[model samples]
Target chain A: MARNLLRAAAALTVATLVGCAAPSLQVAEMGSFHVGGRTVTLSGLPAKELVFTPGAPPLKLDPNGDFEVEALYARYTRLSNPKAKFPLLLWHGGGLAGTTFETKPDGQPGWENFFLRAGYDVYVSDAVERGRASWARYPEIFKSEPFFRPKKEAWELFRIGDTDSYATDPARRRALPGTQFPVAAFDQFATQAIPRWGTNDAATQAAYDAYVDKVCPCVIVVHSQGGNFAFNSALKYPQKVKALVAVETSGSPNPDTYDFSRVKGVPMLWVWGDNLGKFAFWERIAAQQEKFRNSLVRAGGKGERIVLPEIGISGNSHMLMMDRNSDQIAALIDQWLARQGLRN
Target chain B: MARNLLRAAAALTVATLVGCAAPSLQVAEMGSFHVGGRTVTLSGLPAKELVFTPGAPPLKLDPNGDFEVEALYARYTRLSNPKAKFPLLLWHGGGLAGTTFETKPDGQPGWENFFLRAGYDVYVSDAVERGRASWARYPEIFKSEPFFRPKKEAWELFRIGDTDSYATDPARRRALPGTQFPVAAFDQFATQAIPRWGTNDAATQAAYDAYVDKVCPCVIVVHSQGGNFAFNSALKYPQKVKALVAVETSGSPNPDTYDFSRVKGVPMLWVWGDNLGKFAFWERIAAQQEKFRNSLVRAGGKGERIVLPEIGISGNSHMLMMDRNSDQIAALIDQWLARQGLRN
Candidate 1:
């Protein structure tokens, strides 16, 4: 009961933390593109591959065919006003696709449109083996089986609400108060959930690295789990990244091991929703991020940590980029980018 | 950890269930009024009271002073169109006042304006010893110490979100995935959380009964703990209650003891948000109400249970009346009232 009380108390921060004011511009153009993939040649004996179809003959293929791996898919939305200095690249976290920056589940426009409207060309991408990038079969190129996120894990790890909220009994699901994510369209959000593997990092990193090489000298917006790639990418090629915007990202480049001097000129912004200290998961994430930020600062790097509540916006969850006030936050980001000289 | 999972699962219903369609007509004429209060007379000892001032001498009352008890306060918003067949009386639940029907904490208009605009004279009331109906001193007219709802309990019991969402750490608070409550203005919602006591039921019941008697043959919209009084009052005076709309109510009159036949002609509507089965507390309330409804049906009573998600309206919390789409819900009730043949 005491724990329940504490849990209840912690939930309020989720409701009252993140928010936005309004928008000043609108989108003018939207487009899409794909980049970064490699074909692997097989030298061993021929391997059999079976393809099944409904009410049709199955096709069998021999190992003579090469497998395509580590391809990245991207969609670009360019604004007519062209106020931003360069295109903004949006990188989604693990198990998610470029759809994160596209239309919302509730049919509202996504951040891609909002940023475009705010005068910046926006590029949303699907990392290797995710979304439109497509994955290769195991034992050939990949080593392990891909694991899917259970609905329960999504509700908890995503901080949608509490664990009990996803109970089979419809009545038990109580959302934390003040959550801004469109809970009604959660099914839409869940539709974006895909299979992921822990062992795919090496290939994924390679694909992302290639993507950055292609789209250098642009602003980067990274979400949960994508933080590591964004940080490492920015560190590896500092001249390519103008500014880094990390939205509730889960990982970062090791502050101790990474070459901090590389990122000294790159301004980074870490954004957080409400209720960080309450949940053990979030508390740990926040602490580590803070440490990372401190380390960066100690190394004479420039960065800012923007907690939503500190700016009078409240009740935002981790998915702030897809929230009802997504545009508002996007506008705020636009303003932040302008301050960083990444935008006009 | 399992319990936490359960809690997280239970919290989802609070976000995604219970909703309303958009309103077809916006209110045209809007207005307000206040009424209902009385003073108690004493016989033997002289009743004297003293009033304190900030920078002046204290004022004293004479021995003829009388205390006021069980005086309900009501604010009536009359519509010029008068499309409804009867006046609508809004009764709030436990620990809350008539302000539930007023302007929303998020600065959105409350149900009072919506109903009035929909063409009903909306009577919003503060039950005895609550809101404008000021409580008397303990040991005199009142008994026992009143307990206040902590912000934490409000977040939990109210189905706002998870515990961590309320943590003081700005980063820890995460709103549920799909909550529609105006989380940004939660402080305003908390302001309405006044002191309440379990022992005040009798007096509250009497006051409610008296108020119903004063305004008979009206449609009643009851919320939360107010369900008990609304049911009993309707049963006791069947002809006075034209119809009843109970929104996320916590309690109801037992079917075994009550004369169900008395309420047979009084149509009732029970509305529930998402996730009743997730939280044990709400689960019990929902079960009991279901049983009560079944009993009413057995007695040949006409009643309908409107589970938000079952009907396709999702992402509503327990405080549906205070949600972002509150007006839409109000319109739904209006449609229901028309279906009941109570609207013009």
Candidate 2:
């Protein structure tokens, strides 16, 4: 069946990406967030459940897996505005957490503050590891899609062997001791911590679900790595999603690589550089069904793509959004979003 | 109309970029190129007659003009195996440029070479000035789509406004006073020329057409800006396009901002970041559109967004694909593509 499928499509796939996807489980949960500055705290917040902490809101998750769930909301200043849509969950990239959309670098303008000032409600969260959180979990590289199958057949499709296990191998343990720390850290980050912080986290998922059920998000704005989490969560609870704006993709490989790709018709943007974009090396994996590329074509989402060399951003770092000329990035995105016909 | 259109997509997608009928266009031009160390002589290159030379490739409107074109192709080599299905121009990002598929760093495997070693024809060329040349006649931004009403609309979509004006901007006045230079040369390359280029130009178009006509490009591996060009270009020639792998998108906004629901179809990977994918910045623009975030929800595409806190691509510039760590990037693209089942 696989060979035949390839012969039929690869022979003439004016629009099909080769070899990608597998059905998996779709998990959903929710949690409450401590909303920050915004107008109409009630409206800006996604339509979900928010339970105020009886006393002090616990920072750490319950060790025994018992944790109270609540919905996060914004104390937006412009609640009176009837035209205001429900505030959204504005997530930033990694590094320092907390600086909501309301505040930006050097007080120039924050995504939160700008929206709030414009009569829009927003909930911002920093993608911080939250203390020893980054290291606590025993992250494993669980294959959402089986990576260890008939290698020869799938090898041409561009699958990786047990690449990261180099450090753990007993034979090479002495030769590559330094590789152990970062790889283990990465594994944990990808497996345990990510699911927890992302929509997959049982408590956080519950809280997010509660919020979504309450306010009914008008849109979700995510940047960098947070963009993936936000979108992944939305996929888990697609019915609760309205729209998304992914700033700079970090990991948007194949949909089947994950477990879900259904929606009640949501709008999204996959931002990238000029000509082509590869989230962590598209050249490596783009051969398989070319997930985002092939699927969109098959689905018939004839949208426009923007590829620029660098909108005046020249730096040597992982953060392109925060480049020296970030204004260009910001202004371009704003102008484009404004063009999207989205309401404030 | 422009306002309404922008309102629809949430971003100004001036598009339908393409070349016009010109008798000067010819077939099968050949040339030799030495880039990133490898030197190969291309034979029977398509659109050879359009090579930008003194007079061989004449301009569309100007008889005594100079113009040239380059073909574009990309393929990934298995980091584990050099000999594999080296499909050329078979991968790409949706909204970014075409070159985003391969790494831009030297001593690194060019995706095209990867395929070449893997036994596939690789055709790549430079994109600049105009489809038909005499760089003077061609503006920095060319019509990457088909000829449409309101030429500005297409330009707006691609976000290359004031092309005629920018061409005359005195900022980068060539050398001394008054003398002018092509806008592509202004980059602080620290030298008179730069080797890294775009997946555009006549040569690329011809190559794309040829690939479409023959193998049917099952996977379109695009990153960053190439997404825009690839999406629109594929739109113009849908028969030639199979599937789309639009990595971090920057061009797509809401074709209509108010209508957050209607999106063109194509399976998509909406990768997002902490902020907007920095493309270009200009006056009157602020705020970043979570492009990948928003795009995932576009009307039709089935999208899986992956957000990572850190790409761990050290010393790598976002103008990646050519920057350092391209192998890692390629590995990821290859992995994604493999999942899609387009190994060949």
> Which candidate leads in lDDT?
1
TM-score (all chains, Cα) for each model: 0.46, 0.29
Chain B TM-score (each prediction, in order): 0.84, 0.44
Give the alpha carbon lDDT tens digit for every residue of B44-87 in model 1: 54433332223445333322223334556554534435789899
Listed models, DockQ each = 0.01, 0.01
Q: How far off is residue B75 in model 2, in Å?
A: 48
Q: Label model 1 with its docking quality class.
A: incorrect
Fnat per model, in the order shown: 0.00, 0.00
Docking class of 2: incorrect
Q: Candidate 1, residues A171-245: lDDT per residue as tens digits?
A: 565666887888776644654555565567767777788778987779999999999888988887899999999
Per-residue lDDT tens digits of candidate 2, residues B209-278? 4444544444455555445455555555554554455544545433444232322444445433222222
